[model samples]
Target: MDEETRAEILEATNRALCEHGYAGLTVQRIADESSMTSAAIHYHFDTKEELLNAFLDDLIERFESKLPCGAADPRTRLDGVLDAVFSPKDPDSDGFPVAIMELKAQAPYHELFRERFLDFDGVMRGVVADIVRDGVAAGHFDEADPEEIARLITTMSNGAHARAVALDEHPAETRRVVEDALELHLGWTPGEEVDG
Candidate 1:
């Protein structure tokens, strides 16, 4: 398959998923969202499940690549991550998180989806752990366990999305709570530690 064609199909799949949740998603809908036909999409991806798995793979890769360019300071890096994770999906697509939520709701029945979600969570948790580890190593954060803090943040991040999409809670409130939790765990605050 040509790289361009594959990318087009993936982009179309994302848009279709955003418009129609996982339960409503179909190859025809994806084709309608793109400039391709169902046959063309199938020529590259044998099934809708396969295509969606690929889409999740693409999402994780993009997220991983985007995270490292953040500031070197641990506090700033953590702030950058929280902002990115909680920001609106896009200007026009407020339903993006709900789409993801729907897919997550299916994880129990779909083995591949469960695995994909596990991979996605692992990526986020790993990034958080790395930041926390660096922070502690540099003495910028407290001596608490990095993985524990990462798990706390990752779980809260997931809850924040759920509350925002399902319970009509504002994302900023949850984000602020996560920030306060981080400060409690890390024992550091911005502009408080003098430069050495």
Candidate 2:
């Protein structure tokens, strides 16, 4: 496949998923969102499931690339990751979150979706754990288990995403709670000058 064509199909797939969600998605709908025909889409992707799987891969790849891998310190990296995930936005402005949640709802029935989601979750958890471990070594965080802290923060972040899309709840609300929990347990507060 031409790289441009593949990007177009993935972009169209994102829009189609945003508009119709997983249940109503179809190749025709994706074609309508792009300049391609349904036949062209079918030529590249034999089924809607395959197209969705590709889209999920592209989505996660883009997100992972945006993570703060080269930040100067663990605190900065942690804040960058948290802020990116919990950034405030009008729920109506972005349908991608809703679309993702819709697909996530089918993870039990869709093995591919479950695998991709699990991969994303594990990567994120590992990122957070590494940051926590660095913070502990630098004496920025207390001697708590980094894995437990990462699990707690990531789980809260996941819940925040679900709430933000499903209930139109602001992500900042959960972010504040997570921040407080981190401060209480790790003695590390965002934007504070902790000993290093």
Give TM-scores for every candidate, taking all chains together and pairing residue i with residue i: 0.91, 0.92
Shift of residue 135 alpha carbon in model 1, Å = 0.7
Model 1: residue 41 alpha-carbon error in angstroms: 0.3
Model 1: per-residue Cα lDDT over 62-168, one tens digit each: 77776746457776777667766776556776677788888898889878889999999998988888888988888889888888988998888899889988897
After superposition, the stretches of candidate 2 with alpha carbons farther than 4 Å from their true spots are 90-93, 193-196
> How many clashes does the backbone of model 2 have?
0
lDDT of 2 by residue, 1-196 (tens): 9999999999999888888888899999999999999999999999888888898888778778868875558888888878777888645547888898888988899899899899888888888898888988988788888889889988998999889887989999999999999898888887665345
Each model's lDDT comes to 0.82, 0.86
| Candidate 1, residue 77: lDDT | 76
Model number with the top TM-score: 2
Model 2 vs. true fold: TM = 0.92
